[model samples]
Target chain A: MRNLFAFISGALFGAGLFISGMTDTAKVQGWLDVFGDWDPTLAFVMGGGILPMAVAWLLTKGRRPALGGEFPTPPAPKIGRNLVVGSVLFGMGWGLAGLCPGPSLASLSYGGFGHWLFVVAMLAGMMAAVPLRARLAEPAEA
Target chain B: MIEQDWIWGFVGGLLIGLGGAVYLLVNGRVMGASGIVGGLVDGSGMRTVWERVAFIAGVILAPIPIYPIYRTVETHITSNVAVIIAAGLLVGIGTRLANGCTSGHGVCGISRLSLRGITATVFYIGAGGITMVLFRHVLGVI
Candidate 1:
């Protein structure tokens, strides 16, 4: 039952990406173009996503845990250098490639060859981080 | 007043957001795509593995139903495969460094009114914005 729900939810997400035209690289690139044929599509997409999410949050507040038994959701982070640095890196990559991880994966199912490289490189990047994160934590242990 | 594209975008975002909410309400877990995927590799339980595999499969197969409805022409901004690969790698690393992707931190985290999610999202958006300025405005990629 849990697996079924997750699968359905994921399907919905992929459908959203495709319908929003987010899977299309041109639309993504258009957003990147500030002066040249600026496309507000991505902004619109994000805005659309946020509205319902806001309402859902309100509805679900104070509710007990539902799936996979009980677990406390992680605490939200305070604003800091991590936020700034991470955002900058994410935006730079998005602007350059017009693909984020979610849509990148979605695009792959649609025969999006562009996402092939993005997906590969993304996996590599994740793998690379295991050691870096370990190294960063080493000093804390010391 | 609504353009066809905007209608599609709005609907798509809503579905994705709603689906996310359903997952949270039912599972007590944030529907972070990367985390779900990651769980497949590292998670110990049989349930966890099944859920992750199902979710990923759903995401991959979602475009099939929608392909006939919106037949937008696909376009590629950068044909260079290397660039795409590099961008994906960067995102993977960034997600790991931050401890979540946009779906986990940006969508689920923010919805729960988490400070960390809000901070992570800010960075995620900021990164896209700055990268756009640099790539399109400064470097003239777009």
Candidate 2:
């Protein structure tokens, strides 16, 4: 049951990504390209997504998830170095490829070999992050 | 006054949010795509392996049926191998370090008014725009 719900949610999310034209690298690049032919569609997408999710957060308050576990709570909203540096790095990649994690995965069916290569590299990066994070955290711990 | 692309984007964004709502309310987990896959790669998500697999399966498979109806799904990912590798590594490392991406931080985090989410979004989008200007205009490499 838990897995089923998760799968449904994933499908909906992927379908949304596909229908929204976010799977298109050109469209995504257009959004980032403020100087060039700018695309405002992404703004609408963000607004549309935020409105419902804001309400969902409200609903989750004081209410346990329908499933058996407790709702996962967010940690303190800290403005940490990792967050800033990581985000900038992410943004650079996003601008370069016009593909983030969601769209990258969602578009795999038709994204061809280039997409496959990107995913493989991304996974490798993710693996690297484990050790990298540990090393970065060492200073703070010390 | 809404453009056709905007309409699609908005609707898709809403669906993505709705998917997030379901994930939170039913599965008691936030629908951060990178985190889901990252955990699997880093071996941190081994305990909930099935759930993660199910969600990923849904995301990948969702577009299969949509392809027939839409008839075309274009990703436009760049063919430049070097750029692809660099971008992929940055994205994977960045997202894992920051702990979210467009869907997770941009949608879920901002919706909850979490400072970390909002900050991350700003940095990433800002960085992406700058990178776009640099790469597309100055460097002309991407």
Candidate 3:
């Protein structure tokens, strides 16, 4: 039952990304291009996404353990190194190529070498982080 | 009145939010695309692999239905393969390190108004915007 629900939800999310034209890399790139022929399509998508999510957050607020399982821990409040540096790096990549993971998966059907290349390289990059994160977790040298 | 692109963006955004909200309401998960895929790849999410697989499957399956209705969603993705690959690598590492992306931080994180989410969003957007300015206007590499 839980898995089915998750599948359906994922489908909805995917559908939304496609219908919103988010699956189109050009559109994402256009939005990021801000100075030249800037497109506000992503802004609406952001607004459209935030409204209901805000409400959902409200409903789930008091439900510490959540309805189905123990709630995942909220991210720490402090502005940390990983968060800032990672975001900057992601921004550079997003600026370079508008393909983020969600759209990348959604647009796999489009099947261009570029998308495939990005996906594979992205996976490799994710893998590279495993040891990096492990190293970060180790105690600092004296 | 907004253009068709904006209208579709808003509607699509709503669906994305609905998808995310449903996942949270039922599964008590964040439904973040990067985190979902990244965790599994890194092997941390192995315990809950089925749910992640199911969710991703839905995302992949989404375009199948959407294609019938929204034929010809044009794309202007970069043809530069190296740029695409590098972007992919950066996004992969960045999201893992930063812990979120557009879907996770831009939508899910900002909606809840979590400090980390907001800060991360600012940095990524700022960096992306600046990168675009330099890349397009100054560097002209893009």
Candidate 4:
């Protein structure tokens, strides 16, 4: 049952990304081209997303949600190297491809070879990180 | 068609938020693509991998039924296969390292005013903006 609802939510979210300009690399690229022929479309998307989520947060404040579990809160660790470096790397990639995971996965249907290439590599990169993180975590390293 | 993109962007963003809210309300999970997918790959959230996989299935399949309606959903991603793969790899690894992406940190995290989420969002976006400037303006390769 939980899995079913998760799928439904993902479908809805995927539909949103598909309908929004997020699925189109051109739109995402254009939005990023702030010094060029910039497009403000994404700003609207961000605003639109924040409004409802804010409301939901407010409503669910001081209580566990309708699901009878705690909200998926952020981890409690302080800011560190991984967060900054990883995000910067992510930004560079976003600039390069103009597709994040949501749009990247959602748009796979129509993304053709180029998009598939990105997805496959993305998976490989993700899998690769597991061992890399372990290696870094090894006390012998530093 | 292009002029009204923000309108669709807004609507789609709303649906994304609504989907996220529904997921949280019913399943006690955040609809963060990177975290969901990354967790499965990195083997941290092993207990809920099935739920994450189900959501991924939804994201992958949701656009199919509506493909006819949004036939214009093609990607203009660059043809440099190496760059494409590299970008994907970076995004995959980076988002995992950072623990979120646009959906998780930008939408869900930021909406809830979580410090970590906001910090991650700012860093990634700032990095993206700088990357865009370098690639598009300074290098003229994009």
Candidate 5:
């Protein structure tokens, strides 16, 4: 039952990504190109997405999940180094490829060999992150 | 068709939000793509691997049936292998380090008014825009 809902939600998100032109690298690049011919469609998507989610967050308040698990607590408000550095790195990659994680996975079937290569590399990077993060955290701990 | 893209984008955004909402309200988990797959890559989510796989399966498979009807999926990603690899690595590592991606931070966090989410979104988008200017306009590499 839990898995079923997970699947359904994933499907919905996938469908939305496709319909929103997020699966298109050109569209994403255009949006990022604020100095160039800026595409404002992504803003609409962001705003539209936020509306329902804000309400959903509200609904989650003082409530447990309908399923048999505790709802995730809100993340602490602390602004850390990892957040800044990671975001900058992620943004650079996003600008270069115009493909974020969601679209990267969603576009696999239609995206061909090049997309496959990207996914493989992305996975390698993910694996490397565990050690990389530990090394990054070491200095703080010390 | 192009001029009215915002409409479709908004509609799609709603679906994406609804998906996130469902994932949170029912599954008691944040709908973060990179985190989900990252757990699989880093061996941290070994116990709940099936659930992660199920969600990913939905993301990958959902588009197939809907492709015929929607048909707006084109990712004009660069064919430069080096760029692709670099971008992929950056995205993978960056998302993991940050512990979130566009979906997790941008949508889920921002909707909840989490400062971390908003900060990540701003930095990423800002960095992406800068990268675009440097690469596309200034350097002309990508």
Candidate 6:
């Protein structure tokens, strides 16, 4: 049941990306162009997403877990260098490729050859993290 | 038609976020799209498998309803296939290293006001941006 719910949620997300012109690299690139031909459409799409998410968060606050299991909401972090650094990286990538991981996967269903490249590289990136993860953990222990 | 395209994307993203939140609320899950899909091949329980399949299916089929109102135009950006693949691999590695994707960290985690999530999300976004700047501006891939 949990898996089913997760799948449906992903589908909705992919569908959303497809409809929002997010999967279209040009649309994303347009947003990245700060000075020229600025397209604010992606902002609207993001805003649209935030609205519902905000409400959902409010409604679920202090509520017990609902799926007959515990939901561990991770602790918030202090605003620090990590936040600034990560956002910059994310924005740059989004600007360059016009395909974030989520949207990139959605583009695959449409059978775009380009999406295949993105997905394959994404998988490779994920695999590369294994060593990085071990290194990060080692520092914490030491 | 163009106007409608934007509308559909906005609305679709909104709905997907809402659906994902609700599913998470009801199912005691985080609604990480990639994890759900990944679980399908990992031999999770029947319920999980079904949900994962359904979510992916919905993603693929959801756009059908909106297709009539909007025609998508393919973007033309020239880059070597190998480069694109490398980028995707990097993203995949980043997600795993961070323990979540954008949706899981950016959307769901951020919504819950999680600090680690926020940190991880920052890393994901930052890494992406740096990669883009290097690829597009410095390296001139696109």
Q: Which of the two candidates, 2 or 3, achieves a greater lDDT against the reference?
A: 2
Instruction: Assess candidate 6 and give its lDDT.
Output: 0.61
lDDT of each: 0.70, 0.90, 0.85, 0.83, 0.88, 0.61
Interface RMSD of each: 2.3, 0.8, 1.5, 1.4, 0.8, 3.5
For model 2, what TM-score does chain A reach?
0.94
Using all chains and alpha carbons, the TM-scores for the candidates as numbered come to 0.86, 0.97, 0.94, 0.92, 0.96, 0.77
Judging by TM-score against the true structure, name the best candidate.
Answer: 2
Candidate 4 reference-contact recovery: 0.79
* DockQ, all models: 0.61, 0.88, 0.76, 0.73, 0.85, 0.44
List of clashing residue pairs for candidate 4: none
Off by over 4 Å in 3: A64-67, A134-142
The interface RMSD for candidate 6 is 3.5
Encode model 4's per-residue lDDT on A11-120: one tens digit a residue.
98999888877988888878878888888888888777878888877767677866577876657746766777778888888888998999999988878998989988
- Give the better candidate number (4 or 6) by DockQ: 4
The window of 10 residues in a row where model 5 chain A has the poorest summed lDDT is: A133-142
Better of 2 and 5 by DockQ: 2
Report per-candidate TM-score of chain A alone: 0.82, 0.94, 0.87, 0.87, 0.93, 0.82
DockQ, structure candidate 6: 0.44
Sorted into a CAPRI-style docking class, model 2 comes out as high
Candidate 4 per-residue C-alpha lDDT over B53-139 given as tens digits, one digit per residue, 9 for 90 to 100: 889999989989988876477778999887898899999988887778999888998898888788988898787788789987998
Candidate 3: pairs in clash: none
* Runs in model 5 lying further than 4 Å from the true structure: A138-142
Highest lDDT model number = 2
